[model samples]
Target chain A: MTAENVTAADPDTTVRAPVPSERRGPSSSAPRMLWGLVVLVAVSALALTTDGFVSVANARAILSSVSFTGILAVGTVVIMLSGNLFSLSIGTSAAVSSMLFLYLLPDVGFVLAVLLTLVAGYATFALQGAIVGRLDGNAIIVTIGAGALQVGAVTWLLPGSVQVPDGVDIGFLTRSVLGLPFPLYVFLAVALLVQCWLHYSATGRQVELVGENKAAARAAGLPTGKLVTVAFAVAGLCTAITGILLAGFNQNANLAVSGTFTFDAIAAAIVGGSSVIGGRGSAARAVLGAVIIATIANMLLLRGFGTGVRVLVEGIVVVLVVVAAQRRKRSIA
Target chain B: MTTRPGMARLARRSRRGGLPYVLLVVMLLVFVVLPVVAGQQVTSFNYYNLFQVFASLGLLSVALGLTMIAGEFDLSVLGTYAFAGLVAVKLGADDPVVGLLAALVLAALIGALQGALVAWFRLPSAAVSLGVYIALLGLTATISDSKTVPYNNLNVSDVLDRQYLEIFSLRSIIAILAVAAIAVTMTYTRFGRDVRAIGSDRRASLRIGVRVDSILVVLFVLSALLSALGGSMLALSLAAATPDPGFDPLIFALTAVLLGGVSLRGGTGTVLGIAAGILTLSLLRELLTVLATPTYVSSLATGGLLLVVAFAAAPGLNAWWLSMRRPTKRVAEPPSLSRVG
Candidate 1:
């Protein structure tokens, strides 16, 4: 029996429960130890696999990759916590943002273009959230439809062919600042801030409660609908930020690439141990998951795996991580 | 139990089944009237074009519906479709029949294994199947070198293309067969009820002694086999197997199924509803094409349609308004399923 259950049980009615509870505490610690072992082993494997996996260069690469995805994952984590299975528009949001940023770079500086894209992404996601949160609709379908519309809009709005302008290419943005790439530093800072907010803030606690049991949360007086909408809007902001970084990395914005990020972000978040059924995720895991995926992908590319094989491996890893997480959750419960 | 007047009104509406029927009628009319409103010839062409698109796409939708009914999502439809198509093309050398059978069986095996993993291990279907999709997509590319194989032999296409006796329509016949088979399984088979029961309530089904895991595994296998069959047929019809036929079909099939009023929650949809969904979406696409909408515009329309239908079908807005307008204490909790999915 759990410690909570033992305390909840009547003293006279559950005399034997104390015996189990005494044993359960030591056993419960084992799971915590196991979590530590998993992290230790994963870090070790990453260190051993690549020559400089622990080096500044590798760390920067990992951070850059994780930041964009981590930002998106944070948003998705909120939605997932709210009990939604998937958010469909993130990919299109990213694509639209990237395309818009690229198209506008000539007219505006890269930074302003990025800001504009972020606002657009936030607005679009807010719209999606409102529709999902307010109007009774399938989250998957609504976002997917919205995504498609956005992709189409981007395609029409931008000139033919899917490449970024030369002005916005990686030359200026790729340089390291303060011993770490700007993107990586940005991602870490965001992760720390979000983690603090989600852990300590009243709104964070309310969001968690909403995720855990919407009925109960509502009963306790919470703005469940608006909360869900905000979560989606946050996800949009993450997607837009990711798109900007991605545009910098590629030195070109491509809609095709943007579409893949949709599932990639989901996979990364899930692999890092985010729950699909919702109400469980952390910025740390979100970033960790993105790192793991990006590492694996980078390795596959280095190993010269065909596109098909690389995708397959990446997919398998995602499934395995999710399955493992689910099994763990079930066993613990 | 005492209830307010508004609550009583809502209860009464639930008892009346008019809403569903009205929605169906409206959708049908949209498909029929909207195209004609644009232009007459275009609408008529859409009727014929609609059949081809439906035959190709409906196969995957039905397959997805089966899995959806079992309360799981498989994102591997794209890969499986591609895998099956590639298999057919590679084996088309000796005999078209051999090639066809090979593709179907390979796909079935892959499906069964995936289904087994998902059900037996209780793995998330989306996650597991996505892995399968990626692996199969890789396998297809590695095996076929990412290029399409064209079988120029007219004999093979001729044999696979037409309905029996040249009088019947091939695509139409397949559509009928698929619908019939699914209908029979759903309406008559014990297995079908088992699936529905599990979908309706997994815990309750388990308590009632249903073999929830085994039944789901079988359902996944069956769904995969059907998807593979669809891919193979498409390959035979087109006389070429490319690496990407599967990719396009998956999303479109999903849109069709959801639009058909099959609850994504599972266990509440019908083959007829699915058919209507497919026909409606496909016809709309054809209508758009006939209207000379650009390719990008066409896709945008598809997405827009999905959003409209999603909102209209479920209406989260009402739920939000109810939650916000009513005092927090007086408002009952939103339905748990409604909030999550």
Candidate 2:
């Protein structure tokens, strides 16, 4: 939680307002600690109170199912940490790519389909990144517009759902590896890779630095614009990857295949201890956050709550998390 | 209060037939000229089709513009839109008076809650509203049980279907009146100036004694009320309420606001511009409907239009009022050289 604490205030590092907040180290850790406790209590309560929640089957279900959002959360957290705020179009791009993957699979085969979908996703985000990163436009609203554009365009071209041909095999995607689902492995691998990149690689550190203080990064001779664009590009790719993974799993990509998971991914990022203000957090933290959300959802399903009740719970949780996160940000600032 | 020059420039600017009026001209061409050129008869008979679009969507554009002018977002307002329609149609099944009050009250409370949180926390309004939107979606589902409640019990028309000049409905009248009132409030009142001030610079506004939070709170509440009212009115007009109208209107309204020439950064926009923008979109939609294009195509067109308008409108904001063809004094001459996009 206090990743910033370990980041020593090299004269270059503390280029922005070098406030006392910079020195206020261990306090931010309180939230992470509290989060740990919350997760612990909630897990025990669910295990103790709910039926069959502690079983391995249920554990596998929860873990494998939420990896879709888990992967998405990693990308969103990285984007937020890099100081781009959030992308409203995450779901849109994912849905478009999912549709694209489904459509292209029969005509071009699987590998090419996946590659083309990733390229399409990368192109979409690259444009948004260029516009926002270079022009200093409002990221949130811009994405909203782009999302609408994408949905509209896609709907215009293809208004109906398509199914993957029965002959197309997703056995490899569905198959387990070392007792875990393949999807879970991919999710974890991506998260770990991102964590390593953020903590170890020079480029990753520069991305974080650029996010923390764009002006400082510019002064320190960082390729701030390119890094920010790369951040968005990565985000776009993650969502597209998740989309194709989902198509592979579900064998269907309905025109209305929802990217509603975008909001959930963001909520997970917040709960996982990522700051919306940017330049702080890890992919593992986001994965943890995704797990927390999945646990709540699993418990609700276990309790036989209706979709309405589950949705309401998710909404309230997001609001509360945002409130607490904003409060923490203000206190530190 | 140092408002003299800004107001004076605004007054001079409004008389100059600016961008809003230019958009109005475009709207008229779309509504009248092109259709005629295409050999389509858009008589008073089908004018209601256009009016209905304006009545429902234009009101939303006006409502969104009000908040945008104050520098805030209210994403949950559309959720209230669907929710309000449900409340009014369901509660007013027998007597609309009960439904109207219930829906309005519910909208007020929802807006109040959102407004308070947004003001107190200083959180990004987008994220906060996302929460509200999702929660409200759940609430609407729970209440309606995910069913599209048919509103056949009442002669909805007796209560709200009154028409003017054989074209305008009572709902349009109410909407226009609401918009007119907002126009006056934003233009002549000190509160409007404060909103502009805060948008221009929050800290400076605070130093100048602007009640930034309160202004924002009111704007949010007002936005909710408008959204709810718009939703209810549409429901009343249609004589039914869907469980999920979703955020379609929110996006359309936003596009219209930008089309109306409201800056995304807030302030420096006029209600007249937004009104014209709303009309332009309504006519565009009407034309597409006439052409029998699919929903997605129109949506795509609208979204593309919004992006183009947003980018192109900002630099020429002050200059557009004169005429689309007339260049402003400050508009550089041919960029003094060739330029890449």
Instruction: State candidate 1's DockQ.
Output: 0.38
RMSD of 2: 7.0
What candidate 2 gets wrong by more than 4 Å, as runs, is: A1-25, A39-47, A218-221, A328-333, B1-17, B157-159, B313-341
In model 2, chain B matches the true chain B with a TM-score of: 0.84
Q: Estimate each model's TM-score.
A: 0.83, 0.87
Q: Which residue window of length 10 is worst by lDDT in model 2 chain B?
A: B332-341
Candidate 2, fnat value?
0.42
Query: Model 1, range A231-266, lDDT digits (tens) per residue?
Result: 677777777777777777677776765645666677
> Among these predicted structures, which one has the highest DockQ?
1
lDDT of 2 by residue, B19-70 (tens): 7668767777777777777777676646666666666777767777777777
| Residue A51 displacement (Å), model 1 | 8.2
Model 1 per-residue lDDT at A81: 63
